[model samples]
Target: MCAAYGEERASRTRINPAVLILGFKIHRSLRMQQSNKPEEQSASILRSR
Candidate 1:
């Protein structure tokens, strides 16, 4: 959905490609951080042991 919106924005505007790509990278990292949250919780628990 985010990608779809990005595509739409890209087509509808004259935004710079580098900005679009950077936005995509930021979004991907945010998504990855969300998915990794649980794993990080366990790792923190272990680290405290």
Candidate 2:
């Protein structure tokens, strides 16, 4: 219920251009390692549920 809503919001926020740019920079800095911050964000959002 609320968890689903939080997940949706997290996905929406991550799709923002600013977040995309930040993701690109982070990916470059990590040399292409997978990103976990977004997952963490989603998790935090779920916790708020």
Candidate 3:
């Protein structure tokens, strides 16, 4: 199903070092652009779901 495919893709991305590093870099840039609280909120939100 679509949900299974999505889960697989998400896990792949999470496991991929290159993809994870890129994602973290982007997240870091966004955190730099905005403020600390938003980044913390986003991090928590990401952890939740």
**Top lDDT hit:** 1
Residue pairs of candidate 3 with colliding backbone atoms: none
Per-residue lDDT value at 10 in model 3? 63
Assess each prediction's global lDDT (C-alpha) against the native. 0.79, 0.62, 0.66
Candidate order by decreasing TM-score: 1, 3, 2
Output the better candidate (1/2) by TM-score: 1
Lowest lDDT sum, 10 consecutive residues, model 2, at 26-35
lDDT of 1 by residue, 1-49 (tens): 7766777778887889797788789789777777668888798789999
Off by over 4 Å in 3: 1-14, 36-49
Question: How far is 13's C-alpha from truth in model 1 (Å)?
Answer: 9.4
Model 3 root-mean-square deviation: 10.2
Candidate 3 — what's its lDDT?
Answer: 0.66
lDDT of 3 by residue, 1-49 (tens): 5444544676866477776576667667765655568777798789999
Candidate with best TM-score: 1
